[model samples]
Target: MNIKYNLVVLAAFCCTAIGSAQDIVTQEQAVKLALENNYGIKIAKQAVEVAENNTSVLNSGYLPTLTGAAGATYNLDNTEAEFSNGAPPTSLKGAESNRYNASVNLNYTIFDGLGRQYNYKSLKEQYQLSELQARETIENTVLQLFSVYYSVAQLTENLDALQETLEVSKDRLVRAQYQFDYGQNTKLGVLNAEVDINNDSINIISSYQELKNAKRDLNVVLGNALNPEFAVSTAIDFKLQFQKDDLFEKAKTHNVALLQTEKNIAISELDIKSNKSGFLPTIGLSGTYGWNKNNNNGASFVSVSTNTGLSGGLNLSWNLFDGGSTIIKVRNAKVNLETQKLQKENILIGIQRDFENAWEDFENKLKIFNIQQQNIITSQNNFERTQENFKIGQVNSIEFRQAQLNLLNAELSRNQAKYQAKLAELQLLQLSGELLNVDF
Candidate 1:
């Protein structure tokens, strides 16, 4: 028997079931919109740039500093002088003195017990960690988008099925009314058909409302403005061809959380080095060039003087003790490093646990998908038989309605199972950190 258009066959529905005017989205297009407009992703990218800016040599204290200064001074006073031998005395009413000076200085830390190197390494690690965090945000956002998109598709399929049922009910009511008028069927039959039609209408309205809500949710995640209402295509497909061992390996290398924990451990080690550096001697180099001029009037000395010179020197500082502050800090840093090591181990264990569970779930969901496919086939065959009996008057209207409802239920169940399996697969991919690499 040929499956009728109202039965919602899985292979054919994707091609013709959805409304053409409303169906404006595909999974690929949805993903692209999310990447371009999602606010979380934009913020995360900015954070990565901040980390990049902090990873410079100047920020890591590996550069020299130069300073310049200039100043002028003037003085005026009356002056008097007397000879010690009492031969004469002298006085001047308007005596003036002026001086001008300018200087440039350069200072550089030549050595700091390798603390600068460790700090620079830490900055680089921080930058890498930011990149990992940004990648994680992208993956998580896209994952959410896929879930909502799939939901819209599921609801679209459900709405179509309900509309088909409503149409079928209306046709039944027309036939029932005609039969009653011709004395072929009783009034009770016509009333039953009417009641069923009302029920189908209600179901259609409810399904339609649910579909709109799902679309709205999808729009919000896609970063659409004003949460515009729209529809999506019912075309969807997925494949299950993953090996657990391969996923485990990928998680070890690509998982963002695990990588972040490892990075923190690296940073903690550097922190220990930085703290221990306080115990070492710091050596620095400094240079200064200065120019100065002075003019004197009515003075028993040189009338004008000028001086210019370049001065340079190296200085060293050794922190022999600081009330044991450095020792205490070193101890704390070592403890923190150990804690980070334990955290790394914990994260690794968690990744393994999550991957195993997700892999198991993926397999189970795929199995359920296969079973739903078979169940739909059985329901379809039974419905076809019931439909034939009803036409020939061998079966009643109630039996026909039951068969129709069964077929609809089967269609819904199979659609949900397919999407659930896809969701499970996506979870597995996310756990393995391979979601970012998915192109479609």
Candidate 2:
């Protein structure tokens, strides 16, 4: 009785392990996991944080600097003094001295041709640019996630179709073997059927391997362990409702890349102003308060002394000449500004081109999807008719095999077209900066 109980326990454990090894991941869950755990998105978020931290008022030189310091020293030495008027020399052994000092200083830049103001503005814009760049990274990651997820779905469909074809081939093989055993069919027919069965088996294996690879890639995108067995939801559906003109207009302003370029132009203009500020005199205020003490141990004259004082001043500085480097910098900054403008134009052109290409692809895939959808139905009917005919010995194996292949190819094509259409639609939305808000 105990042995039987142990066996039952072992069986239950095995079942639980098998069940826990397989996971069912929906598309929405995959996207959420990627957003939470993707390494690239995390790095981009950190970069934005760094930019925010660097945009402080102190970094822009708007705040004064205050510093305080103190120190003390002790010394011991032999001292000798020579009197010029008297022809005698005097010496003392083990002379000792001590000294102390402390100070607090403040410095503030009063004026620098509005350079600080421009610098502050540029820093703010830099922070904004970093944020846009992070958003771009997120969008790209999400798009890639969607693509990989759909690819796995497509491969899964292919694997299913191949399995179905393998079953059909196996059935044909069995029929051929039975006929051969009864001396009703040629041995050549049995051999040919065996070859078809083997071929179908090989195709199924290959399709399953491809599906595994696709799932591995999806795991990589989701930042999950590579070896886990999981299944993705098989629903692939999306819609595009915006016109081309509307998409173009939205992309012009909302696209992260273009917005980043605009920020760069503004930053470059500020850079020019900052460099020009070097040509103007700068004004500042500085103040210091200090105390000092000195002691000569057991000395008759000036045994101890202490002093304290407070001092303040206004300072002015001007870079009268710098071998023309400042002016050259200003010129280069202006050139950079122009380059940024040209870059913005180039990005706009590229964005328009991408949007047009994606639009075209989306439309083309929709058409292909429709064609393949009808093809699958026709192929299925043909395959069924040919299969029945083969069973009745009214059609040859070659004709029936061809119909089977047609049905398999049609199903695979339809699956691919459906996913491809979804991908193209996603890409179009991505280019228009609407992908961030898209529902999975």
Candidate 3:
């Protein structure tokens, strides 16, 4: 019984650990999850659906529509009556009446001043534009995901650097104590070493807090529960391969906002045409088939009759005058179309400038990364020389500790530069509309 209880407790502990393990979603997995579950994206998707439905409704004007109707009614009346059987007769009577009718109506627009055509075309353009807007939302979500994921990883790397520094400081303190006991080092040296260790300890604590904050930020972006114990992959390589010229060219063609704006301008033009359609005549074909029934019950007798018939006709409607409302609407539509055209041009210019700026930022970050790589090498060598000198009693502990701190700073700078370069590359890719295609 004791052994069984121990086994059960061990199993429970293992199960709890597994359940509490941090979910490390990959970039692709994160994107897929967000597309499926992100509230903003879901709302955008619903908007797209509404646009599609509108398109369908607009298209329906071109198709024949059949409608059906049926109805029945009855009435009851009460009154006093008198009758004379001589040359004239006068009577007031209680009566009941009933009627039934049914009809099937059909309408086909043979011609509608071309309004339906223009409206349908405009709706199609609008639908496409909405889809493009949804794509833009997706791109933005992915950018946020990338930023959050890399931020968490960057903070984790900083923690590792701090921990390593802490360990090195502790080792130096131990050596300083032994050397002082053997009369090879001064008490001041040992005290300086101890102070450096204490500083590193503080740094480690600060780094831990930063890592926790980074994790929290990531969870918020991912729409996950805010728990700081999650783990993420920290090993990242920042080598970027891209051609600036190619990216710039792709941005002009593939950017979602630019494409969507162009579609908007097209739809605006169609809107102008549709609003002007009122001045033209509309032509249609209509048909109806129905059943009519009547029942009569009076003092004379009772009778019932039913009839069925079919009817068809051509229709033409023209609005010759409408208080100048049609003219005003046409002018307003024209103005709107012109405004949309100007807006589209402005958006194009903005996108071009954005692409150029992102490229510049990318190049600058790459240069910094290259410089920092050399700085790290130089700092590491200098720190090693200082360590040797301190061990041989040629230098004080202050010099050694400063050298160590310098190395740590150099490492941190390099890490920052590396990730900054990656971020800059990502920005450039996004501006160029290449992020969706990139395999990384």
| RMSD value for candidate 1 | 5.4
The prediction achieving the highest lDDT against the true structure is: 2
In candidate 1, which residue ranges exceed 4 Å CA deviation?
1-23, 74-98, 225-230, 295-304
Tens digit of lDDT per residue, candidate 3, span 165-208? 76677688789889889998788867776666556656655666
* Candidate 2, residue 8: lDDT: 35
TM-score of 2: 0.89
Worst 10 residues of 1 by lDDT: 1-10
Worst 10 residues of 3 by lDDT: 10-19
Q: Candidate 1, residues 1-440: lDDT per residue as tens digits?
A: 13322332332333243454454777778888888888888899999999999998769888999999999999887888786777567787888888899999999999998899899999999999999999889989988998988888888788777777766776777877888899988998787877776666566656666776787888888777333545666675674455778779998888888888889889989999988899899999999999999887664567888999999999999989899999999899999989988888888899888988888888888899899899989998998898788767788889989998998888898889888889888888888888867757
Backbone clash total for model 1 is 0
lDDT comparison, 1 vs 2, better candidate = 2
lDDT of 3: 0.76
Q: What would the TM-score be for candidate 1 when compared with the true structure?
A: 0.88
Candidate 2: lDDT of 92?
A: 74
Candidate 2 accuracy as lDDT: 0.84
Candidate 2 Cα deviation (angstroms), residue 265: 0.7
Model 2 misplaced regions, further than 4 Å: 1-21, 73-94, 225-227, 297-300
Looking at model 2, report the run of 10 residues with the lowest lDDT sum: 10-19
